[model samples]
Target: MINIQLLNKDFESRVRLGIMSILMVRDWVEFKELKELLDITDGNLASHAGALEKNQYLQVRKEFVGKKPRTTYAVTQLGRKSFQDHLAALEKLLGQP
Candidate 1:
Protein backbone atom coordinates (compact mmCIF):
# COMPACT_ATOMS: atom_id res chain seq x y z
CA MET A 1 0.00 0.00 0.00
CA ILE A 2 1.10 3.56 -0.73
CA ASN A 3 1.69 5.99 2.06
CA ILE A 4 0.01 9.33 1.43
CA GLN A 5 2.31 10.85 4.02
CA LEU A 6 5.22 10.48 1.65
CA LEU A 7 3.86 13.34 -0.39
CA ASN A 8 5.36 16.61 0.70
CA LYS A 9 3.05 19.27 1.99
CA ASP A 10 5.43 22.00 0.85
CA PHE A 11 4.87 21.01 -2.76
CA GLU A 12 1.12 20.57 -2.50
CA SER A 13 0.47 23.69 -4.49
CA ARG A 14 0.84 23.52 -8.21
CA VAL A 15 2.72 26.80 -8.08
CA ARG A 16 5.34 25.37 -5.77
CA LEU A 17 5.54 22.23 -7.85
CA GLY A 18 6.09 24.29 -10.96
CA ILE A 19 8.75 26.34 -9.28
CA MET A 20 10.70 23.29 -8.18
CA SER A 21 10.15 21.61 -11.52
CA ILE A 22 11.73 24.49 -13.35
CA LEU A 23 14.59 24.89 -10.92
CA MET A 24 15.30 21.18 -11.14
CA VAL A 25 16.49 21.60 -14.73
CA ARG A 26 17.90 25.12 -14.74
CA ASP A 27 20.61 26.32 -12.40
CA TRP A 28 18.71 29.45 -11.65
CA VAL A 29 15.77 31.50 -12.91
CA GLU A 30 14.86 35.12 -12.43
CA PHE A 31 11.64 36.12 -10.73
CA LYS A 32 10.07 37.60 -13.83
CA GLU A 33 10.89 34.56 -15.90
CA LEU A 34 9.30 32.26 -13.35
CA LYS A 35 6.21 34.42 -13.15
CA GLU A 36 5.82 34.36 -16.91
CA LEU A 37 6.53 30.65 -17.19
CA LEU A 38 3.98 29.82 -14.51
CA ASP A 39 1.52 32.42 -15.82
CA ILE A 40 1.07 33.82 -12.32
CA THR A 41 0.94 37.29 -10.87
CA ASP A 42 3.85 38.81 -8.94
CA GLY A 43 2.09 38.44 -5.63
CA ASN A 44 1.22 34.85 -6.34
CA LEU A 45 4.78 33.91 -7.15
CA ALA A 46 6.13 35.82 -4.20
CA SER A 47 3.82 34.16 -1.73
CA HIS A 48 4.59 30.68 -2.92
CA ALA A 49 8.29 31.30 -3.20
CA GLY A 50 8.24 32.76 0.27
CA ALA A 51 6.74 29.57 1.63
CA LEU A 52 9.42 27.45 -0.02
CA GLU A 53 12.07 29.79 1.31
CA LYS A 54 10.73 29.41 4.79
CA ASN A 55 10.99 25.66 4.46
CA GLN A 56 14.61 25.97 3.31
CA TYR A 57 13.70 24.26 0.08
CA LEU A 58 14.70 27.17 -2.12
CA GLN A 59 17.31 29.87 -2.34
CA VAL A 60 16.42 33.43 -3.18
CA ARG A 61 18.92 35.98 -4.41
CA LYS A 62 18.23 39.65 -4.80
CA GLU A 63 20.51 42.03 -6.65
CA PHE A 64 20.49 44.85 -9.14
CA VAL A 65 21.56 45.00 -12.72
CA GLY A 66 22.32 48.62 -13.53
CA LYS A 67 19.23 50.40 -12.25
CA LYS A 68 16.95 47.39 -12.42
CA PRO A 69 16.39 45.07 -9.50
CA ARG A 70 16.56 41.35 -10.12
CA THR A 71 15.39 38.43 -8.01
CA THR A 72 16.39 34.87 -8.75
CA TYR A 73 15.64 31.47 -7.27
CA ALA A 74 17.19 28.01 -7.21
CA VAL A 75 16.50 24.73 -5.55
CA THR A 76 18.59 23.79 -2.54
CA GLN A 77 20.15 20.35 -2.08
CA LEU A 78 17.49 19.48 0.47
CA GLY A 79 14.83 20.54 -1.98
CA ARG A 80 16.26 18.39 -4.74
CA LYS A 81 16.21 15.31 -2.55
CA SER A 82 12.78 16.04 -1.15
CA PHE A 83 11.30 16.65 -4.55
CA GLN A 84 12.82 13.47 -5.87
CA ASP A 85 11.37 11.52 -2.97
CA HIS A 86 8.00 13.07 -3.58
CA LEU A 87 8.09 12.06 -7.22
CA ALA A 88 9.04 8.56 -6.27
CA ALA A 89 6.14 8.36 -3.86
CA LEU A 90 3.81 9.58 -6.56
CA GLU A 91 5.06 6.97 -8.96
CA LYS A 92 4.63 4.27 -6.37
CA LEU A 93 1.17 5.51 -5.64
CA LEU A 94 0.38 5.25 -9.31
CA GLY A 95 1.80 1.71 -9.37
CA GLN A 96 4.52 2.68 -11.79
CA PRO A 97 7.17 0.86 -9.72
Candidate 2:
Protein backbone atom coordinates (compact mmCIF):
# COMPACT_ATOMS: atom_id res chain seq x y z
CA MET A 1 0.00 0.00 0.00
CA ILE A 2 2.85 2.34 -0.79
CA ASN A 3 4.24 1.99 2.69
CA ILE A 4 7.23 4.00 1.67
CA GLN A 5 8.16 6.49 -1.00
CA LEU A 6 11.10 4.29 -2.01
CA LEU A 7 14.74 5.12 -2.42
CA ASN A 8 14.51 4.29 -6.07
CA LYS A 9 11.82 3.38 -8.58
CA ASP A 10 13.07 -0.15 -7.98
CA PHE A 11 13.95 -1.70 -4.54
CA GLU A 12 10.23 -1.81 -3.90
CA SER A 13 9.45 -5.52 -3.84
CA ARG A 14 8.74 -7.41 -0.64
CA VAL A 15 11.42 -9.86 -1.66
CA ARG A 16 13.85 -7.05 -2.26
CA LEU A 17 12.89 -5.63 1.08
CA GLY A 18 13.62 -8.95 2.72
CA ILE A 19 16.93 -9.25 0.98
CA MET A 20 17.93 -5.70 1.84
CA SER A 21 16.72 -6.11 5.40
CA ILE A 22 19.01 -9.09 5.91
CA LEU A 23 21.93 -7.59 4.05
CA MET A 24 21.65 -4.49 6.19
CA VAL A 25 23.01 -6.58 9.04
CA ARG A 26 25.78 -8.37 7.21
CA ASP A 27 28.83 -7.99 5.02
CA TRP A 28 27.46 -10.02 2.13
CA VAL A 29 25.11 -12.86 1.41
CA GLU A 30 25.11 -15.81 -0.94
CA PHE A 31 22.30 -16.25 -3.47
CA LYS A 32 21.19 -19.49 -1.92
CA GLU A 33 21.42 -17.95 1.50
CA LEU A 34 18.99 -15.24 0.46
CA LYS A 35 16.67 -17.75 -1.15
CA GLU A 36 16.57 -19.72 2.09
CA LEU A 37 16.14 -16.65 4.26
CA LEU A 38 13.25 -15.34 2.19
CA ASP A 39 11.81 -18.82 1.67
CA ILE A 40 11.55 -18.02 -2.04
CA THR A 41 11.84 -20.16 -5.10
CA ASP A 42 14.90 -19.79 -7.30
CA GLY A 43 13.05 -17.89 -10.01
CA ASN A 44 11.52 -15.46 -7.56
CA LEU A 45 14.84 -14.76 -5.90
CA ALA A 46 16.60 -14.23 -9.20
CA SER A 47 13.98 -11.83 -10.48
CA HIS A 48 14.01 -9.63 -7.41
CA ALA A 49 17.79 -9.65 -7.32
CA GLY A 50 17.81 -8.68 -10.95
CA ALA A 51 15.67 -5.62 -10.23
CA LEU A 52 17.90 -4.48 -7.39
CA GLU A 53 20.97 -5.16 -9.48
CA LYS A 54 19.59 -3.11 -12.35
CA ASN A 55 18.92 -0.21 -9.98
CA GLN A 56 22.47 -0.44 -8.63
CA TYR A 57 21.22 -1.09 -5.13
CA LEU A 58 23.31 -4.25 -4.97
CA GLN A 59 26.63 -5.48 -6.21
CA VAL A 60 26.51 -9.03 -7.43
CA ARG A 61 29.53 -11.15 -8.16
CA LYS A 62 29.30 -14.56 -9.73
CA GLU A 63 32.05 -17.03 -9.24
CA PHE A 64 32.75 -20.67 -8.56
CA VAL A 65 32.24 -22.15 -5.17
CA GLY A 66 33.68 -25.64 -5.15
CA LYS A 67 33.38 -25.91 -8.93
CA LYS A 68 29.76 -24.84 -8.83
CA PRO A 69 28.78 -21.36 -9.86
CA ARG A 70 27.96 -19.13 -6.93
CA THR A 71 26.38 -15.72 -6.78
CA THR A 72 27.08 -13.33 -3.97
CA TYR A 73 25.45 -9.99 -3.28
CA ALA A 74 26.71 -7.12 -1.22
CA VAL A 75 25.11 -3.82 -0.44
CA THR A 76 27.05 -0.97 -1.87
CA GLN A 77 27.76 2.16 0.17
CA LEU A 78 24.97 3.91 -1.74
CA GLY A 79 22.73 1.01 -0.91
CA ARG A 80 23.41 1.37 2.81
CA LYS A 81 22.49 5.03 2.69
CA SER A 82 19.38 4.35 0.66
CA PHE A 83 18.21 1.62 3.01
CA GLN A 84 18.64 3.89 5.99
CA ASP A 85 16.68 6.62 4.31
CA HIS A 86 14.00 4.20 3.35
CA LEU A 87 13.65 2.95 6.92
CA ALA A 88 13.58 6.43 8.32
CA ALA A 89 10.88 7.42 5.88
CA LEU A 90 8.82 4.39 6.78
CA GLU A 91 9.16 5.19 10.44
CA LYS A 92 8.06 8.72 9.82
CA LEU A 93 5.10 7.57 7.83
CA LEU A 94 4.10 5.31 10.70
CA GLY A 95 4.25 8.36 13.02
CA GLN A 96 7.21 6.88 14.87
CA PRO A 97 9.28 9.97 14.23
Candidate 3:
Protein backbone atom coordinates (compact mmCIF):
# COMPACT_ATOMS: atom_id res chain seq x y z
CA MET A 1 0.00 0.00 0.00
CA ILE A 2 1.25 3.46 -0.79
CA ASN A 3 1.46 5.85 2.10
CA ILE A 4 0.22 9.21 0.89
CA GLN A 5 1.19 10.58 4.29
CA LEU A 6 4.81 10.11 3.31
CA LEU A 7 4.50 12.87 0.78
CA ASN A 8 5.69 16.28 1.91
CA LYS A 9 3.12 19.02 2.25
CA ASP A 10 5.72 21.69 1.85
CA PHE A 11 6.41 20.63 -1.70
CA GLU A 12 2.77 20.31 -2.67
CA SER A 13 2.79 23.44 -4.74
CA ARG A 14 4.13 22.93 -8.25
CA VAL A 15 5.90 26.29 -8.00
CA ARG A 16 7.74 25.19 -4.93
CA LEU A 17 8.54 21.87 -6.53
CA GLY A 18 9.94 23.58 -9.56
CA ILE A 19 12.05 25.86 -7.41
CA MET A 20 13.53 23.00 -5.47
CA SER A 21 14.04 20.95 -8.62
CA ILE A 22 16.10 23.70 -10.17
CA LEU A 23 18.06 24.30 -6.99
CA MET A 24 18.81 20.62 -6.65
CA VAL A 25 21.18 20.57 -9.65
CA ARG A 26 22.48 24.10 -9.59
CA ASP A 27 24.61 25.43 -6.81
CA TRP A 28 22.81 28.73 -7.05
CA VAL A 29 20.26 30.38 -9.29
CA GLU A 30 19.41 34.03 -9.68
CA PHE A 31 15.90 35.38 -9.14
CA LYS A 32 15.52 36.48 -12.74
CA GLU A 33 16.73 33.17 -14.07
CA LEU A 34 14.38 31.24 -11.86
CA LYS A 35 11.43 33.38 -12.86
CA GLU A 36 12.28 32.99 -16.53
CA LEU A 37 12.74 29.26 -16.31
CA LEU A 38 9.55 28.79 -14.31
CA ASP A 39 7.63 31.13 -16.60
CA ILE A 40 6.18 32.93 -13.61
CA THR A 41 5.81 36.54 -12.66
CA ASP A 42 8.19 38.18 -10.21
CA GLY A 43 5.52 38.37 -7.52
CA ASN A 44 4.63 34.73 -8.05
CA LEU A 45 8.18 33.59 -7.67
CA ALA A 46 8.70 35.82 -4.67
CA SER A 47 5.68 34.43 -2.87
CA HIS A 48 6.65 30.83 -3.53
CA ALA A 49 10.29 31.41 -2.65
CA GLY A 50 9.22 33.10 0.53
CA ALA A 51 7.24 30.04 1.53
CA LEU A 52 10.23 27.74 0.91
CA GLU A 53 12.53 30.10 2.75
CA LYS A 54 10.22 30.07 5.74
CA ASN A 55 10.44 26.27 5.81
CA GLN A 56 14.26 26.44 6.02
CA TYR A 57 14.38 24.38 2.84
CA LEU A 58 16.15 27.08 0.93
CA GLN A 59 18.73 29.82 1.40
CA VAL A 60 18.51 33.22 -0.14
CA ARG A 61 21.41 35.52 -0.87
CA LYS A 62 21.16 39.13 -1.88
CA GLU A 63 24.04 41.14 -3.21
CA PHE A 64 25.00 43.71 -5.75
CA VAL A 65 26.85 43.15 -8.97
CA GLY A 66 28.38 46.57 -9.37
CA LYS A 67 25.29 48.80 -9.28
CA LYS A 68 22.84 46.05 -10.06
CA PRO A 69 21.05 44.30 -7.24
CA ARG A 70 20.97 40.55 -7.48
CA THR A 71 19.31 37.75 -5.56
CA THR A 72 20.05 34.05 -5.65
CA TYR A 73 18.73 30.88 -4.09
CA ALA A 74 20.09 27.45 -3.13
CA VAL A 75 18.72 24.39 -1.42
CA THR A 76 19.92 23.58 2.08
CA GLN A 77 21.18 20.24 3.35
CA LEU A 78 17.85 19.58 5.04
CA GLY A 79 16.11 20.46 1.80
CA ARG A 80 18.12 17.93 -0.19
CA LYS A 81 17.28 15.16 2.24
CA SER A 82 13.63 16.12 2.41
CA PHE A 83 13.29 16.37 -1.34
CA GLN A 84 15.00 13.00 -1.82
CA ASP A 85 12.66 11.43 0.65
CA HIS A 86 9.70 13.00 -1.11
CA LEU A 87 10.87 11.56 -4.42
CA ALA A 88 11.26 8.15 -2.87
CA ALA A 89 7.72 8.29 -1.55
CA LEU A 90 6.45 9.33 -4.97
CA GLU A 91 8.33 6.48 -6.61
CA LYS A 92 6.85 4.01 -4.18
CA LEU A 93 3.39 5.34 -4.94
CA LEU A 94 4.10 4.70 -8.60
CA GLY A 95 5.22 1.14 -7.77
CA GLN A 96 8.67 1.81 -9.13
CA PRO A 97 10.47 0.48 -6.05
Candidate 4:
Protein backbone atom coordinates (compact mmCIF):
# COMPACT_ATOMS: atom_id res chain seq x y z
CA MET A 1 0.00 0.00 0.00
CA ILE A 2 1.14 3.55 -0.70
CA ASN A 3 1.66 5.80 2.26
CA ILE A 4 -0.10 9.10 1.94
CA GLN A 5 0.44 10.59 5.36
CA LEU A 6 3.28 12.97 4.58
CA LEU A 7 1.34 15.79 3.04
CA ASN A 8 0.89 18.69 5.41
CA LYS A 9 -2.65 19.92 5.76
CA ASP A 10 -1.40 23.41 6.44
CA PHE A 11 0.10 23.64 2.99
CA GLU A 12 -2.87 22.21 1.13
CA SER A 13 -4.10 25.63 0.09
CA ARG A 14 -2.83 26.84 -3.29
CA VAL A 15 -2.12 30.22 -1.78
CA ARG A 16 -0.02 28.67 0.93
CA LEU A 17 1.67 26.43 -1.60
CA GLY A 18 2.54 29.42 -3.71
CA ILE A 19 3.90 31.20 -0.69
CA MET A 20 6.08 28.24 0.15
CA SER A 21 7.27 27.89 -3.46
CA ILE A 22 8.40 31.50 -3.52
CA LEU A 23 10.02 31.36 -0.10
CA MET A 24 11.78 28.14 -0.97
CA VAL A 25 13.74 29.88 -3.74
CA ARG A 26 14.41 33.18 -1.95
CA ASP A 27 15.52 34.05 1.53
CA TRP A 28 12.73 36.51 1.98
CA VAL A 29 9.70 37.93 0.20
CA GLU A 30 7.94 41.18 0.85
CA PHE A 31 4.23 41.17 1.68
CA LYS A 32 3.33 43.42 -1.20
CA GLU A 33 5.19 41.22 -3.63
CA LEU A 34 3.31 38.16 -2.40
CA LYS A 35 0.01 39.98 -2.54
CA GLU A 36 0.61 41.03 -6.13
CA LEU A 37 2.09 37.73 -7.20
CA LEU A 38 -0.78 35.73 -5.78
CA ASP A 39 -3.27 38.27 -7.09
CA ILE A 40 -4.92 38.18 -3.68
CA THR A 41 -6.26 40.92 -1.51
CA ASP A 42 -4.50 42.05 1.64
CA GLY A 43 -6.93 40.26 3.93
CA ASN A 44 -6.72 37.05 1.95
CA LEU A 45 -2.97 37.02 1.99
CA ALA A 46 -2.82 38.03 5.59
CA SER A 47 -5.15 35.23 6.62
CA HIS A 48 -3.09 32.59 4.89
CA ALA A 49 0.17 34.10 6.10
CA GLY A 50 -1.20 34.22 9.61
CA ALA A 51 -2.03 30.53 9.42
CA LEU A 52 1.52 29.73 8.35
CA GLU A 53 2.89 31.91 11.11
CA LYS A 54 0.68 30.20 13.64
CA ASN A 55 2.04 26.86 12.50
CA GLN A 56 5.59 28.16 12.94
CA TYR A 57 6.19 27.48 9.27
CA LEU A 58 7.24 31.03 8.50
CA GLN A 59 8.58 34.06 10.29
CA VAL A 60 7.31 37.55 9.77
CA ARG A 61 9.41 40.67 9.95
CA LYS A 62 7.87 44.09 10.09
CA GLU A 63 9.95 47.16 9.49
CA PHE A 64 9.64 50.65 8.13
CA VAL A 65 10.64 51.25 4.54
CA GLY A 66 11.15 54.97 4.72
CA LYS A 67 7.97 56.05 6.51
CA LYS A 68 5.78 53.19 5.39
CA PRO A 69 5.66 49.87 7.13
CA ARG A 70 6.95 46.91 5.21
CA THR A 71 6.38 43.30 6.11
CA THR A 72 8.49 40.41 4.90
CA TYR A 73 8.31 36.64 5.34
CA ALA A 74 10.87 33.88 5.51
CA VAL A 75 10.36 30.17 5.83
CA THR A 76 11.71 28.43 8.90
CA GLN A 77 13.99 25.42 8.66
CA LEU A 78 11.19 23.18 9.87
CA GLY A 79 9.00 24.60 7.15
CA ARG A 80 11.56 23.85 4.45
CA LYS A 81 11.86 20.28 5.67
CA SER A 82 8.13 19.89 5.84
CA PHE A 83 7.75 21.20 2.31
CA GLN A 84 10.43 18.84 1.06
CA ASP A 85 8.73 15.92 2.70
CA HIS A 86 5.46 16.97 1.20
CA LEU A 87 7.02 17.10 -2.25
CA ALA A 88 8.57 13.71 -1.74
CA ALA A 89 5.19 12.35 -0.77
CA LEU A 90 3.74 13.79 -3.94
CA GLU A 91 6.48 12.23 -6.01
CA LYS A 92 5.92 8.91 -4.35
CA LEU A 93 2.24 9.20 -4.96
CA LEU A 94 2.96 9.66 -8.66
CA GLY A 95 5.33 6.65 -8.62
CA GLN A 96 8.31 8.92 -9.17
CA PRO A 97 10.24 7.14 -6.47
| Candidate 2: worst-modelled 10 consecutive residues by lDDT | 1-10
Q: For each candidate in turn, give its C-alpha RMSD to the true structure in angstroms.
A: 1.4, 3.1, 1.5, 1.5
Candidate 1 CA-lDDT value: 0.95
Steric collisions counted per model:
0, 0, 0, 0
Q: Evaluate model 4: give its lDDT.
A: 0.92
lDDT of 1 by residue, 1-97 (tens): 6689999988989999999999999999999999999999999999999999999999999999999999999999999999999998888889944
lDDT of 3 by residue, 42-81 (tens): 9999999999999899999999999999999999999999
lDDT of model 3 at position 84: 94
lDDT of 3: 0.95
- Candidate 2 residue-wise lDDT, 1-97, digit = tens: 4465454445567888999999889888999999998999999999998887877789999999798999999988888888888877776677744
| CA lDDT, candidate 4, residue 57 | 89
Evaluated at residue 71, the lDDT of candidate 3 is 99
Question: How does model 4 score by TM-score?
Answer: 0.93
Question: What is the TM-score of each predicted model, taking all chains together?
Answer: 0.96, 0.85, 0.95, 0.93
Task: Supply the TM-score for candidate 3.
Answer: 0.95
Sort every candidate by TM-score, greatest first: 1, 3, 4, 2
| Two-way TM-score contest, 3 vs 4, winner | 3
Q: What lDDT does candidate 1 reach at residue 59?
A: 98
RMSD of 2: 3.1
Error of 2 at 93 (Å): 0.6
Which rank order by lDDT, best down to worst?
A: 3, 1, 4, 2
Global fold similarity of model 1 (TM-score): 0.96
